[model samples]
Target: MPAFKQTQRVHDDAFDPSDSASAHLYISFGAHRIRMGVLDAQRNKFVALEDYEVERPSTVENAISFLQTQSVSNPLLQERKWQQVRIGVKNQQFTLIPEALFDLNAREEYLRLNAVVEPEHEMVHHHEHPRLELINVFTLPAALHEWSVPQFKNSPVEFVHQTSALMEGMLHMAERSARPHLFIYVDKNYVTLVVLQGLKLEFCNSFFFTSSEDFIYYVLFVLQEKKMNPDQDAVTVWGELLLDSELHEILRTYIRHVQFGKKPTGVGFSYRFDALFNHRNFDLYSLHFCD
Candidate 1:
């Protein structure tokens, strides 16, 4: 077992969990961290937020244990039975396919042919586009699904790939923008890039990197391959980055319009969350948009 570092914030100290109103629970799990948010559906405000980081032996058991402990300690989680629960898995071995081309019967074979490892224990999941009638086909580990499924058995639960949620979130955010936009989400050991051109998805992929150099290399490579003008195209970044971080500095050196992303405009958050960066925990916040 490993030690887990946890941080949490309560939006309203006067909030009464015994209230009749129901709330939604959103949780996102990564390689080393877990983030959760409790949203009051009627009030349209977040009541509580939490983050847990496992310093060593970052396994599924440790993550689940951390969640279990939080459920016991956090009053907001314990007092109220949530109306809906959604889990976002941040695994990288996923592929996206259009709705028309998706064949439900060949899901496992499709993933297997794409070189997804441990295909036997992975289940296919999909995220439907809001207006295009398109769907994203991806895989989630059975271990995570099995472990989390039982926890939310009493309520309606849906499992989504983090990338799918991010894509949906970005689509909603970028719908009003006319120019081409590149959205980058950085995590512990991987970076996900999503490109949108006039509300249409142009590209979406994830790359693993060991250092800042490798990170920048992939970004630049994608830009060149996509024929996107680094000097003209706009780039919005999110997740695990500070103003002075090495990754931010490197991106600035090559890209002209690099800026941090903002929280989704559709959701309401309490003032207590003002201290945190608007771009952080994008996947967790975006989970609200997941169906």
Candidate 2:
């Protein structure tokens, strides 16, 4: 079996260029845990760092436990830069008592809580919406507007600008990693595509397909759409959907019509942040998908 390599990041705020950034961090307030890594930005691979988990507790003692666990005689505790702790709590219905305690500190902020940590949650929710933990502000993206997201009452899911921007940012981050190949994630039943530029170069892209047949037709249709002849350019797919045989064949059938190459296959399921966060803030957004 191939060994798994780990990376640690401490967020850009924690890094001072004069000092080497030994940590890379991806934080999910809902998860209450920070994915950390000491990354070789050059290789875009993780080195190592301890994963810090902040738990969900309602009492002052539990809060104390969080502080102690995270601050216990650890090397990170010794760093002055790590001292200005800012806490963000997930939205909870903690009776009036705990809620008042949580408001005592200016260093703390509360955000609506959504993700759960049980194994079942990882399997169900995570897969159902692959990009949840990876996007901006810990929410789903806008592209999910077309999905029929389940909801309370008779409402539909909504998309927002910030969420879209964050997803776009994650894609651009992958590109900035300048690593070749694609970073694929699927959760729920939505698919997201992102290609990296190992050379640290930037390129433009257009949404090319939604299905195998769509993949085939779009290639040729887009060429004509852009006033280009079928025998013009080349195409390469970087998606899991390309793994299916039937779709692959469908893609190949129309390859001759366009200068693009290969068979078409399939895709991933994902969630964008804006679509699933802050019910009070974006109440109009129906949790259900588009009609």
Candidate 3:
């Protein structure tokens, strides 16, 4: 059994749990961590962000059981009157299919092409990107899905893969750009890369890396394979890396215009969130745009 440690938490003084009816809750579940964000819908502002880290669960069953225990003691998770609840699953168990080729009845079959799926233990889910004309088919622990629905009885609980969130956020950022832009999201031991030409997605995938060398290798590989000029194209980064970190330094050494991304626009943020870096939770905040 493992315990979850709170790594970060920030909220405006005006935040109130009783007002959950007017707020949207976003939760992102990763290999060994959970990140949550609360948006005050009425004010169009984000009021809270919390992060928790736990030892990687041995199985999906274990992960769900661990969350079940934590939810009971968490005031925000207990609230059932949220305006909306969005859950972002962060894993490699997903595949994106063009809307025209997607078969509603073959979600499991489509995902199996990229990853092994145990239908008996997991439930398949899909999120459609009308703007992208793509459908993302993924899975979650069957027990987890069953448990989450009741918790949001009065609100809709929508599930999506983290990459879907990234696509939505990146498209929003690339709206006015005429050139292809590269975006990278780094997590504990994985990095998700997305290449966009304005609003159109050109490439997207995730790679696992254990060291700095491996990280740089995958990044440079992608740039070269995509025929992108390292000296000309711009790269925007988000998630766990820092401005002064070794990863950022290595990236700048090779790529000409490497910069950290800002939080998604069109939504306000409380001053309390200023303490966090602007790019910290791009995926969580992007859930607001996931329809």
Candidate 4:
């Protein structure tokens, strides 16, 4: 297993490790990276953020072992007991069902329509979206469950899919505006598109692409299929995109009102975070809104 390399670490000057009892911990697990942040619930502010990158492991056991070994020396993942803990699993193996028709016993069946679920190796979980009136059925590697349960035994923990956080973040943004909006979240090779008309969720799906052309094609295709005018409907984006990059240029050429999303509202961040792009880590930051 390749080592986990530290990529970014930023913390406020007032951060105190001993004060974790009043803070909330948010962690996101992804294919290539793992990110965690600490939020002071009393102040409604984030005090620390850390990101790590690891070479892709060949198998599931290697991935769990790599994290286990790294957690031994990492203070953040150690003995601290937080006020609350939330974990976000990022992947395409998720599907949404109407809350009215959802069945807890059929979680695997609901997810099987879109993904190949191996119950022996994974645990199926569901998150209810009261605002959207839907239930998100997803899977987390069983190894992850085994590893995290004992690590945070002192604190209460809840698990959610990354899309749930993104949707909640987007819906919160829509509440401030009455107009129809299309939100796009881009990753290295996958893009999640969400459409909202005022506060209603009209569309949500993730697409995999290999090139810039493929990325733009899916974005435009979704707009056309939804009868949204590329020149009129506003499109907000979040993730690893540069203002002068090829993807941004392509987006601007095809869409008139393309803008990057902002960091979550209703929560504050330290001034040290000003150097980071507001759009970058939107999903990780939005985990605060999941519960």
Writing each residue's lDDT as its tens digit, candidate 2 over 222-282 gives: 4454443434333344323333455546645654431211111121111221232121111
TM-score of 1: 0.91
* 1-291: candidate 1 lDDT, tens digit per residue: 876787655556745666513888888876578877878889887767878787664876567666677667866456445688888888776777677787778666666666566656677776677554566667776666776666666667788888888888887788555666789999887899998886788889888898999999999988987788999988899988889989999999999999899988888888878878899888888888877
lDDT of each: 0.78, 0.28, 0.87, 0.87
Residue lDDT tens for model 4, 1-291: 666678889889998867889999898887577888999999999999988777554455665675687678766777459899899998899999999999999999999998999888899999989989999999998998999889888899899999999999888777545666789998878899998887888899989888899999999998998888998988999998999998999999999999998998989999989988999989999898887
* Clashes (N, CA, C under 3 Å) per candidate: 0, 49, 0, 0
lDDT of 3 by residue, 45-134 (tens): 999999988755545555677678867988888888899899999888889999999999998889989999987887899999999899
How far off is residue 154 in model 3, in Å?
2.4
Q: Estimate each model's TM-score.
A: 0.91, 0.28, 0.95, 0.95
- After aligning candidate 2 to the native by TM-score, how far in Å is the CA of 181 from where it should be? 17
TM-score of 3: 0.95
Q: Cα miss at 98, model 3 (Å)?
A: 0.9
Comparing 1 and 3 on TM-score, the stronger one: 3
What candidate 3 gets wrong by more than 4 Å, as runs, is 55-59
